[model samples]
Target chain A: MSPPLADLSAPPAIRPSLAARLAARSGALTGSTAGLALGHAQANLAVLPAVYAADFLRFCQANPKPCPLLGVSEVGAWTIPSLGDDLDLRSDIPGYRIWRDGELVAEVDDASAFWRDDLVAFAIGCSYSFEEGLIAEDIPIRHIEEDVRVPMYRTSIDCTPAGVFSGRMVVSMRPLRPPHAIRAVQISSRYPAVHGAPVHLGLPHLIGIADLARPDYGDPVTVKDDEIPVFWACGVTPQSVIASARPSFAITHKPGTMLVTDRRNSDYAVI
Target chain B: MSPPLADLSAPPAIRPSLAARLAARSGALTGSTAGLALGHAQANLAVLPAVYAADFLRFCQANPKPCPLLGVSEVGAWTIPSLGDDLDLRSDIPGYRIWRDGELVAEVDDASAFWRDDLVAFAIGCSYSFEEGLIAEDIPIRHIEEDVRVPMYRTSIDCTPAGVFSGRMVVSMRPLRPPHAIRAVQISSRYPAVHGAPVHLGLPHLIGIADLARPDYGDPVTVKDDEIPVFWACGVTPQSVIASARPSFAITHKPGTMLVTDRRNSDYAVI
Candidate 1:
């Protein structure tokens, strides 16, 4: 489980570097890194065999809103120096999900056991970057306020196809009053690498979301009468696409267990 | 009247400089400058007495979305050289609406007779700059396509008050399909000086706009069943505020007529 709001708000007395955090995670820090290295960029991870890397890259390029590609490692390389110095792709993340034929076969602390010379690591931008922006602007994030996960919905919108990777676009929802929603658009638009502005707002059914209370993934929080549900393109989209593609072997960071990088979230802001 | 779409699309064999256009207007060219000087920035003009200038500047600073101030000339000066070299404020624009105590007293071709030593000229960012951007991006602007004025509405949302200048925010509406609307947000966001992104979208009544067909100003264009109305903070807002404030004397560019500046529209794009 993620830490409470009070705990998340207070950083550790000693702020460790990204290299130090990854080394600690490799040793014993095996859990979600939700609020760790708060100002730095945290990335969603996907590792696949060299054969599927090209197709996946094209998929991300075509559907940038959902799969904002931050960095892609060279084939068989464990280090993506652009994202973090001295980082090991196989062991840097705190937790990993190992998949075979798109089925989750095991959850592990590190991926060294399944590491292969034919693997490629893909780093994707996450909404955590923009959520920090929203919070900085004092925009109320209901899920964080209520201590629940942001609701995720599988929308009617389709991701543009690229080879074997194709599926419906998935979105995360946050309920905000009209004024806050407008401000959210402005704030979020600055961070285009992290899903950018909203993909949809107000009318959910137009995007085929049947109920605000029943999300396809994550937990639903309160949507007050004064607030309208705002939706953003989600990182989970690539995970969903990977499942539908049914690759022979695949790996992803366990949800919320992101790769904490040396890059600050502000680095991704376009303006 | 503005020229037809075909004429507007075809640039004159020899494009005129800002000074040349002003000289033409000062002579016999007295009509809307819509679609003229295709690539250059065009601004809405507001001239007020020195007594009201300070409050008006504060009003613009407080309500930037609607009244994005581009350049404010020195008190009683006719030249805002930053906007255009040798540009005379009194006779540059093709048409002017002279107001006395908030009532439209005259529609003149030149403001030289009305110009006073106590008057201050304000050049405000206009939507025409961003409209060119949208058109370049292949997003069809309904008003421009139908060759009519863009619809404007007085919203329930109030402007942040500054001194004696206070009124409801006025917005300009455009109907775009969902995909085009999403792209519009991205394109418009790059030009913050010209209203930036939309203020409200989709549900019009949520902002107290009861009827889309009967706009408070400008001609209404078609809002198709597949389209959602996107609203942006409009330059007309200051005019509306001036009407309500009822200053002793004021001057504004007549509707659809703007002051063509030497600055390229591209210069205003942040990205």
Candidate 2:
């Protein structure tokens, strides 16, 4: 949905910060933004009409361990000053997924045509924030090091649903040795702005995740001999809920292509 | 080994403070002192002669993850002023295990006869400290509830050997759901003096343990379907190391048996 930013991505120049990244995203830069805006926070975008905004907010509050909320916008608002000044929710994310009546309509580079007065934008925390912390600690996150999207699974753990949002929880997996996993838990626990610490670790079957080699979303990475699969709540939970709610109109970030914001992960560390 | 504390395994007829507990332990009142002096520190006891004491102390220093040293008494001295006022190491513990050439020779209610001029007593932090914290937070420890010893295992993870003391790391197993396990990690991390956070969680096979149904030490507790096994470095590591060293003379607390002190668990809480 971003026009100006989308055009900037076509050039062979590097993108820096939200301003430059948004400039790239708005110009049809429908690509992954995993490491594009290094220092800024990357968010999972969810835009719904004002009619379901209150219910969705409550849903997030009720299921905080899985759906940690970062920021919300006013009705019909495309710009959320809290996240980033001049950042357009409709065009900031690299790619937008348009959902109509709870089904994927079409994936667009920008949401300019779908912008509605009643639509409210929401930014939820994602694993990408804490993943950066892990990397800085020299703790190897197998998925990131292997150049793959972290494997996301649909767990049997259900979210506390609101009026128009209800579904099973989604989790992202990162395989690490036990000690490394313990450190990851300790580090991630500090950032409640992110999905927080993992909802489950090991015992995939206990959480309704049947297969390690096959994931419901994203790419699967190798689980080394000394590693254990550590699972954290995924921002994709809200998307699954929206799909189940089947709203007549909705918008969200394309998986792995998030809305990079001015917020730093350390800003939310509790300890 | 603690005959004074072991004799009265039932709920204390009269609850005692740190001073009273020390008096009873020294007075040959052998009984199970699990909750005898609430809000005070209890320790793992390891008594060795000058020859093996150096090596054992080195073992603990090398593997601080398991054998966290609270205080070590001077050789031939049975009293340690730091852990407790007038704390006599020779007879303060209600029971003591007397070992000869690495073999448990006798289970004595007191160590009056076994106390050697070159013997050195060490006080290591015990899980009882963190377990008390968890219990205060309303977390249920099944073994304590079932009136059985905590199940422990000798894992394939080896300790960094020191002198003649070295062996596989021993871990205590506690079963908890993911959420409780996460909270436990946070709580335990505050008390690094007491082995700190768990060394491993879930995927027991990775640590060389194959069956949860059978334990190498202590009694097995129920493992719920939704629960994942949480493992922590145990105080038993010293006992295992001493077994490997096969010292001519060594004394330690029997499994589940401990030496109560005047130090409060809160005194050691880092945060």
Candidate 3:
């Protein structure tokens, strides 16, 4: 027998992200990129001077869970062709946070004017890929359902030190019932590049997070009494580490906003 | 260059369970078999009349997490050749519990006297296999450390019913810090024939477990303040099911005691 009509009528499973990338470059999509490019992988951006680039690379290597490096551009390059053929690091992301001496100086739609010959862009994997996996498994995501940014906190767990890039790890939280929490662990482990499995779950205080309601970054979603607060190593770790390291100059994507990439999310599923 | 002398001096990593199985068969090891066979796989036994064997097999198929059938013997047969070359179902286990009309009537070192010509024996995977995997990965098991039986409880989660076989799932609990809990999930997932990953974690009451201090089957293990109570589907589910179903006659391994098999735990590691 032939396949069903719906299967024949359906488009390819993975959608391309070139249009979204172009929209960001044109300053027409200057907001949170969450759910913007379905089936495409999103990335956390980090641009630093060549002097600190090698140290940051070591940092990511030593602490892969929180800083999973996807692609890195050569010194002074504005594009990482491996991530996307038309990917322009300076303006392909809808939002950018320019840092001076580890302090956020400005948030802008374009970083082209601030781009310099010494800048090196590092693309780190984001949790959106695994979140998509969880959603596909019918696991409900609290932040997505509530229409709010995921709750993130500063954890007491220290990252393995590498040069000046050292700080406590930051984690994003999701509240799920026990069964779904177990399912999340299995599903997320398949995508090792995207923070992998949770770093902590159940007891928050053990990880040094005092209050689930008062997050260090992003907005808090309701955590039901019966639910477990599962925490994953957040991509925001690099930003926090940069803030602590006090680099003379650095650039990162604003929280909740990410660089949309041309790669399919399925490519990141290791298993 | 030749390998180190120590490598040549060391014996094979996986030790055979033949001696341990022989001891049980001879009635020399008439007690708990928790650590009797170090590198071998142990199984929970369930013997039923041939009339109920088909329904029991369907029940196991419908609820694999709780009743992972490792092997089954022919009606009136006493050996499962696949599990062991000379495995005698009637006397290979360290201890046996005989049930009559859903009530335990006797606990004996060997079931040879009670063995019937119309019975079938089932070998269900036990957690001891994955516990070895967890220990190999340096994940501490609380029950082993405390020298107590791993706690088993009756949960609100119901198993898929088949004919006269039906009951709520029974789970084994282990207290672990959040990080270790996550690691245990990943490690156990590789051995799906042995209960696979956890069914629930953290909140006990959510699974109808009101208190951690009291368990329905095995002795309770200490749960640290910083640790999360992780629960996995226990092989004891079949025992509970047989009891609730009020079968005319049934046989099972006593709590904390099991049937020593020739199969290495590594043989069950699917990944």
Worst 10 residues of 2 chain A by lDDT: A13-22
Instruction: List, residue by residue over A170-216, the lDDT tens digit for candidate 2.
Output: 99999988888888889898888888887778678888988989999
Superposed on the true chain A, the predicted chain A of model 1 yields a TM-score of: 0.91
Flag the better candidate by lDDT, 1 or 3: 3
Q: Write the per-residue lDDT of candidate 2 for residues B28-82, one digit (tens) a residue.
A: 5675667768888888899998877777777888898799999999989988888
Model 1 chain B lDDT-worst window of ten: B14-23
Which one wins on TM-score?
A: 3
Which of 1 and 2 is ahead in DockQ? Answer: 2
Residues B67-108, model 3: lDDT tens digits:
999999999999999998777888878889999999999998
lDDT of 2: 0.84
Residues A1-271 of candidate 1 have per-residue lDDT tens digits of: 9765666667665445465465645567786676677888888899999999999999999999999989999989987899877678788888888999988899998889999999999999989899999899889999889877779999999999999999999999999876677778878888889899889877788888999999988898999876778899999898898889999999998877788887889999988
The alpha-carbon lDDT assigned to residue A215 of candidate 3 equals 98
Model 3 residue A88 lDDT?
Answer: 89
Off by over 4 Å in 1: A1-31, A72-82, A85-94, A108-118, B1-31, B73-79, B85-91
- A201-226: candidate 3 lDDT, tens digit per residue: 99899889999999999999999888
